[model samples]
Target chain A: GPKVLQIPSHQIIDMGQMVTLNCDPVSNHLYFYWYKQILGQQMEFLVNFYNGKVMEKSKLFKDQFSVERPDGSYFTLKIQPTALEDSAVYFCASRSGTNTGQLYFGEGSKLTVL
Target chain B: QQQVRQSPQSLTVWEGETAILNCSYENSAFDYFPWYQQFPGEGPALLIAIRSVSDKKEDGRFTIFFNKREKKLSLHITDSQPGDSATYFCAASGIASSSFSKLVFGQGTSLSVVP
Candidate 1:
C-alpha cells in the first residue's frame, strides 16, 4: 500500500502571514491533490496537480493559494496573507494512476490562522 | 453543484449490531464509488469500493451496496464493534475525465459503536 505524508502536522499562523504546507506523496505515484475540511464539515476539494501543473481547482482554492511540484520532489501548497477562513485541516493525497480511483491520503496538516 | 450526498450525519449502534450509512450522487457519469473511513486525528482510509458494473461488494464486515440506476449507494457494517466507530465518506468519480481520479466526497456519517 502507498502512503502520503505531510510536514508540520499542525501550524498556527497570524492573519496576513504566509504558510507553506508540504506533502510527500508516494514515491511512485503520479497524481497529487489537496483538500480542506473545516471543523465538523465535509472535506472539500482544493486543487489537483499532475505533470508539474494544476489540473483542476475548486472555488475554495483562493487566489492567494498556489500549488507546485517543484523539481519532482515535494508537492507544496502555499497560502499568502492567510485569512481566518483558512483555518481547517488540510489533506494531501495521491494515486498511482488517474483511473485507479482510490486515493492515499496523508495524516493532514491542521492549519490555524489567527 | 455538489455531486455526492450522504445522510444520517451520525449513527450509534450496539456491538454486534448492523450499521448502515447512505449516500447518493447526481452525476450519471460517475461509475466508481468508494467509501472511506476516518478516525479522529487521522486521515481518511479506503474501507471498501464498488463499481457501477456490480451491485454489491463485501470485504469482511464492511459492504457497499450500489444502485447504478438510482445513483445511490450504502455501506453496511455488520457485527459492529467499538473500534468500528468513525466517520465514513462516500466518494464518486468518473473513469476517463481529467478529474478521472478526483474524488467528490460526501459530507460524511459519524458512527459510534457502543460496547
Candidate 2:
C-alpha cells in the first residue's frame, strides 16, 4: 500500500491566522484532492487539483482556501484568515489519472482553531 | 441533501460474528461505490469496491452487495475480528461514468468488535 504523508499531524492556531496544510501524495499520482471531516461528521469533499490547476471545488471550499502542487512537490491547502468553523481533520488524497479515481488518502491533519 | 447516507451510526459486535453495514444513495447516475476503513490516527483505506455492473464483490472476509434497482448497498464482514473494529465509510462517485466526478462520502459507521 502506498502512503500519502501529511505534515503537522496536529495544528492549533488562533482564529483569523493563516495556515497551510501540506500533503505528499503518492508517487506518480496525478489527481489530487482535499477533504474535510468534522468530528462525528461525514468526510466532505473540498477540492480537486490536476495539472497545476483546480478541476472542481465544492461549496464548502471557501474563497479563503487555495491549493497548488508546485512542480510535483507537495500539494498544499492554504487557508487565509482561518475561521472557527474551519477546525477539522483535513485529509488529502490522490489517484492516477488513468485509473478509475479510486482514491488513496493521507492520515489527515487535524486543525484546531482557538 | 446528503446524496450518500449510511445507517447504524454505531454498532458493536463480538468476534466471529458478522457485521452488516448499510448504505443508500440518491443519485441514479452514480455507477461506482467504494468502502473505506479507518482506524484511530490513520487514514481511510480502501476496503472493497463494487460497480453498477456487478451486484456483488468479495475480497477475503469482506463482501459488498449492491442493488441497482433500489440504489442501496451493504458491506458484510464475515467472522469479524477485534482488529476489524474501526469506522467504515461508504462512498459513491460518478467518476467512471462522468468526466466531472468527485467522491462523496457517507456519514460513516463506527464499529466496535469485542473479543
Candidate 3:
C-alpha cells in the first residue's frame, strides 16, 4: 500500500507566528491535496495542487495559507500570522492519475495554536 | 448547505451483530462515493467505495448498497468485531471533464462495537 508521510506529528505554536508543515506524498503520485480537520468534526478540503500549480481551493483556504512543491520536492503548507481557529489536524493526501477516486492520506499533523 | 449528510452521529452494537450506517448526498453530479474509516489518532483510510453505475459493492464483511435514484447509500458491516469500532466518513466527488475532483465529506458516524 502507498504511504504518505507528514512531518512534526504535533506542533504547538503561539498565535500570530508562522508555521510550515511538510508532507512527503507517495512516489509517482502527481496530484496532491491538503485537508483540515477540527477535533471530532469532518475533514474540510483546503486546496489541491497539480503540475506545480494550484488547481482548486475552498473558502477555508485563507490568504495567509500557501502551498508549494519546489522542484518536485516535499510539498509544504505555510501559514503566516496564524490564528487560534487555525488549530487543527492537517492531513496531506495524494493520488495517481488513474481517476480511481482514491486519495491516500497521511497520519496528519496536529497543529495547536495557543 | 451540507452536500453530504450522515445519520446517527454515534452508534453502538454488540459483537457479532450487524451495524448499518446510512449516508445521503444532495449533489446529483456526484458519481463517485467512497467510505473512509478512521481510528483515534490516525488518518482516515478508504474502506469501500461504489460508483453511480453500480447498485451494490461488497468486500469481505463490508458491503455498500447504493440507490442512485434516491441519492443515498449505506454501509453494512456484518459480524461486527471490536476492531471495527471507528468513525466512518462518507465522501462524494464528481468527475467532470477533468479526471480530478475534490471530495466533499460528511459528518462522520462513530461506531462502537461492544463485546
DockQ for every model comes to 0.70, 0.72, 0.77
Positional deviation of residue B105's Cα in model 1 after best superposition, in angstroms:
0.6
Q: What is the lDDT of residue B88 in candidate 2?
A: 98
Task: Please give, for residues B20-44, the per-residue lDDT of candidate 1 as tens digits.
Answer: 9999999988888889999999999
Instruction: Name the best candidate (by TM-score).
Output: 3
lDDT of 2 by residue, B25-95 (tens): 99998899999999987889999999899999999999999999999999999999999999999999986
What lDDT is reached at residue B85 by model 2? 95
Candidate 2 colliding pairs: none
lDDT tens per residue, model 2, A51-94: 89999999999999999988899999999999999999999999
lDDT of 1 at A85: 93
Candidate 1 yields a Cα-based lDDT of: 0.91
lDDT (Cα, tens digit) per residue for candidate 3, span B24-114: 9999999999999999999899999999999999999999999999999999999999999999999999965367699899999999999
Which candidate wins on DockQ? 3
Q: Which residue pairs show backbone clashes in model 3? A: none
